[model samples]
Target: MRRLAASLATAVLAAVGAVAVVGQPAAAHGAEVFPGSRQYLCWEDAQTATGQLDPANPACADALAESGPNAYYNWFGNLDSNGAGRTEGYIPDGTICSGGDRGPYDFSAFNAPRTDWPTTHLTAGATYEFQHNNWAEHPGRFDVYVTKEGFDPTEPLGWADLELVGSVTDPPDTGGPGGDNYYYWDVTLPADRTGRHVVFTHWVRSDSTENFYSCSDVVFDGGDGEVTGIGDDAGTAEPPAACPDEAPGAPGDVTAHDVRATQAHVMWGVSQSGCVTGYDVLDAATGDVLAATDGSPMVDLTGLDPGSTYEVTVRSRNDHTGAVSDPTAPASFTTTTTTTTADNAAAAGACTATRTGASACS
Candidate 1:
């Protein structure tokens, strides 16, 4: 989970008092992770040791043949730029899984209804932490729906067959944008749901008209998020557990700067409560503490390897209540490397200083 930190800056532009002046066409990426979305898991399955896309699942093969690898490469792009949260009346029934094929890529082939396409297993009425990848984070509301009982999986999905299972607005992300990071929330599955059912999620971005859609094939048959139908991992892949959503987790907007070969500085906003005794800097990937600060907003990280990337999240510790707040959306930094030769250093400095005025650094 190396950091590809494109801050969810647009998501919090209002708070920062900034206006977006984007010139290039903006595209976002993400999809449901748990109860693995069709596109998400297929993308995972297509990955091969030879760096080639070879899908093993029959339905995945059919989808690959129809849409090509482009759709699978951009599995998170099942979105509609002009959707603006309009559903039922706007997106047609058969093509709902593809966001009506209005996305930047052609994902129409994924809309085909199939009983096999890598599915997640769950027990009826069980509470589980649902996850949606935040590959490119955005401010949004999520509407999670599951198919009604007696819903036929062999036929294309329709709006009338779905029932609202849960809804959450702007949930907390496990880390910053990219690399297995996701927006997390607890969802209680309907008890009556059995057999083959599709868990559909509609993401309505509040900042823009862009909306994403995900279709997750699942069966409620007394299992624990174990997935089936994808090579040897058919029933071995277990869904990840959700991060705790505790309050007063040090106000967000955690940032890093002054990165160096072995040192860097990270800072964030203050906590809301007086019970916060200190702060802990945690590795965003494993949620392990790397450093601690004595109630300081900023923490200096040292002993980092040169030219290596690290992602870290911050948390507030309340000694009085014996409570620890949730980690901040991760801040990623890569340490810089230095050369021994004086000539190399001077060349590097000159290349960096006025290189901004020139097109090439060399």
Candidate 2:
């Protein structure tokens, strides 16, 4: 792969060190090229609130058929250890997305020749920041390539078909939660490039000989980061079947804690049904409102009297419509008595049962 030149700052290199994990193959760490790679976008399309792959897009559904469910689970890691920068000769022509290896096997199906794969729309000759996920941090260089104009998507992709657009070593780590550090660099799109093309990324690890490969389907129209073929619409891809409308189911595993002098904290599981948008908490003893929330699973009952017994009940709600669920069997808890400094000393002096059921005190 050719290392195309661009003036990247050394300060960007310093940011790479902060994220670098001491010992691990770049295997744990990989990229999701934006506009977006096949696996990355498909993985996003298939995911649900329950962490299930309920594919909403047709191309993603087809990919699920080819690669199976486990492939998307490891979406970022499309890599080959022995690549060593030999792009064309080492990796076979059509199997570029899978890195020409079956070691991380399920990805091979993504290399299937097809034109209907999910695509990201872009404006030609426009400058845009290329974003990649730093799953597990590593010291490597990103080599970006774009398919030449007049490249056909119906056929398999090959090295002869692509042109090296730009390369950057240690791109700045734009922060993201839970190690999804997005590395970004500004690259000007090819002025002559137009129509359907692939933005290929080659991540060459400086720490090891291993290299990662990705294929991002793209169309050079006049678009600006608006992804199609996703969401509730049946725009080229068929949307999943509609969920039936009913009252949201009750939340499970309700619990209470922090039974302090004046307040108690309560929480519960989110309802399994998609209809649940929020929850209504009630005082189980008096059937009065304790608290209600549209967001969090937890709520604190404040202004509660000390040494009082209080029970809180939770009900899942569907905010879209005015439907509330049957209340969960109430989680009953008693508030602890308010204590003074003298009470602490008196309690400490008294004997209490130990782990062995024997009495002990200081």
Q: What lDDT does the true structure give each of the candidates? A: 0.68, 0.64
Give the Å shift of residue 306 in candidate 2.
54
- Which residue pairs in candidate 1 have backbone atoms (N, alpha carbon, C) closer than 3 angstroms, thus clashing? none
Tens digits of per-residue lDDT for model 2, 86-163: 787888899887888644436887886676677778888888888787755566788889999889888888889989
Count of clashes, each model = 0, 0
Q: Which segments of candidate 2 are over 4 A away from where they belong?
A: 1-22, 176-178, 234-362
- Model 2: how far residue 133 lies from native, Å: 0.3
- Candidate 1's displacement at residue 307, Å, is 35
lDDT of 1 at 61: 80
Tell me the tens digit of each residue's lDDT in model 1 across 16-121: 1111101101324678878788988887766543223567777888998898755765576688878999989999999989989887567998888888889988
